[model samples]
Target: MMNILNKILKRYGDIYHPHKQVMESLKINKYLYIVLILIVIEGLLGQYMLYLNKDIWGIIFLLFYGMTIAIGSIFHFKYVEKKFGSLEEFDLEKMNKFVKLVDQEVKIDLTNKEQNQIINQMILEKLERENIKEQKKRAFTGGIFTVLLIPILLPFIIENNQDILILTVIIMLVGIAIIFFSFKSILKDYSLKYKLERISDMLKEILIFSLRDKSL
Candidate 1:
């Protein structure tokens, strides 16, 4: 089953060659996540202020948080803008074929040294993928914790009030809904990471063979 992440990669036609663009896109995604974390922190602070009866300050913080999230989510969705992670579609299948093409058992000339260059880029991409995966896992864990702990802990933190209970439930549900989708992405990232590492190892073997042949 192709997840929405893979669908976005294919639908937006960002999977073309000159894959360096994917690297740039990965950088952009990192920054976007940083922005997202900032928004989350802002909202947390707002909620805390409201708990303390600082309603005006709470509203100001929450207002900015909501606006930033709304705008970023809108632009990232490919509905109005270039779409987040748009150029992050590297063809792992093509990369695997590239490794097989340079197999020692096969008779092919290494006329294009760019093969090594491409593989090096892929290693970097794998590192970037690891970074993204770490972020997603963190989000998943944090969301899960919030979803579980909020209900149990909130009652003890504050006096028993119906409104506060309702608010805690709302926050818990939001946490669950938001991070549930990330599990699929986390799995996909692992699959891609494994394939990339295998391809990297295969290319390294070819490089060794090439060096040995040159020495003889």
Candidate 2:
């Protein structure tokens, strides 16, 4: 059971795993880690207030908790998009060199319709793989957000009046479902946009290489 759980966590964790340069370049990881700690602190405060029967203060703490998450999420999405969209830091120099080397090694008639079609197909395949990665990244972010919220919310609900607790639980389940689906939709849209932007850069390189042999 432990192994299985570990595997599940690993699978989900991969999405949020910053690329090697992500931490160094953006410093987003440090900011996010700090926000996460703040969320935990606010959640604890909320729970403590609820325990003291101060429902209003508890609600305020919870609202602040949610606001912190929302702010962090917005920052994360913007930073990620900015980093991925700007290919300046990307090692395209190496890719260009590789493409040039391949051009030299493989004598392809770029003017031939069939050869041109094959190049297009290869570009499409590259795009598909990138799309898959984008989807996984988005899903991973959503999953992490959902998992973190449960612990924060559970304590307040558990300590409440039984009647209110039952109603809250029902409402909470509905809310969770709504949130999960909403995140899926939002993330999917963002992922596609990000993937398309990156693919455009890659396709430009590939096209430039393919057309190099053709006399205009």
Candidate 3:
């Protein structure tokens, strides 16, 4: 968990690109990690409050959950100046279309627009080639399994001892976080896959229309 938090809490070091920013800037700054830590504490506290039948306090603590988003957004704006290489590796400009077409496309028989269309086709193919659908499937399966296992473990988590119950709540919190992020990632991947499918369908329709015109 510490290792995972360390990665999440990555701070920009001396990463001057000297040319171009090759990654997306962080949406949430490192200092928001404090808020995130507070979030975990809040969860534990909330659960403990509820366990102690302090329902009002539990509700109050739950309301503070919104602060995580508020603090993260504030930090995002505050820490807008990110180093080049320190950013995430999700920049679209850095993605590949075709290595072979680098110089050859300059003198090819195809027009500029046609070459661009071909590159778009290559990009689509490359994106789909990564098999995001399969990954989404795996993530969903794992997430569902973990969620289902939570109920099974809940009997054990619900106990008479205060300390034991709190510890179990902590364990449950970790499991819940895993499920949340896993499904979140799956949804993101599914959204991208859906968009790519739409684009691919449109491209295919255009190709078929062009071919039919040529045949006529």
Per-residue lDDT tens digits of candidate 2, residues 1-216? 334323322332333234634454346446777887899999999999999999999999999999998998788766655766644433454345434443454544333456545654554555576568767866866686678667766766777656676667766876787678767866766654454444345546556755775645
The candidate that wins on lDDT is: 2
* Evaluation by TM-score, superior candidate among 1 and 2: 1
Q: What's the lDDT for candidate 2? A: 0.60
TM-score of each: 0.35, 0.32, 0.35
List the global CA lDDT of all models.
0.58, 0.60, 0.52
Mark the regions of model 3 whose C-alpha exceeds 4 Å error after superposition.
Answer: 1-28, 81-116, 122-216
Model 2 per-residue lDDT at 71: 95
Q: Where's the lowest-lDDT run of ten residues in candidate 1?
A: 8-17
Off by over 4 Å in 2: 1-28, 86-216
For each candidate, how many residue pairs have backbone atoms clashing (under 3 Å)?
0, 0, 0
The residue ranges of model 1 lying beyond 4 angstroms of the native Cα positions read 1-114, 147-183
Evaluated at residue 35, the lDDT of candidate 2 is 84
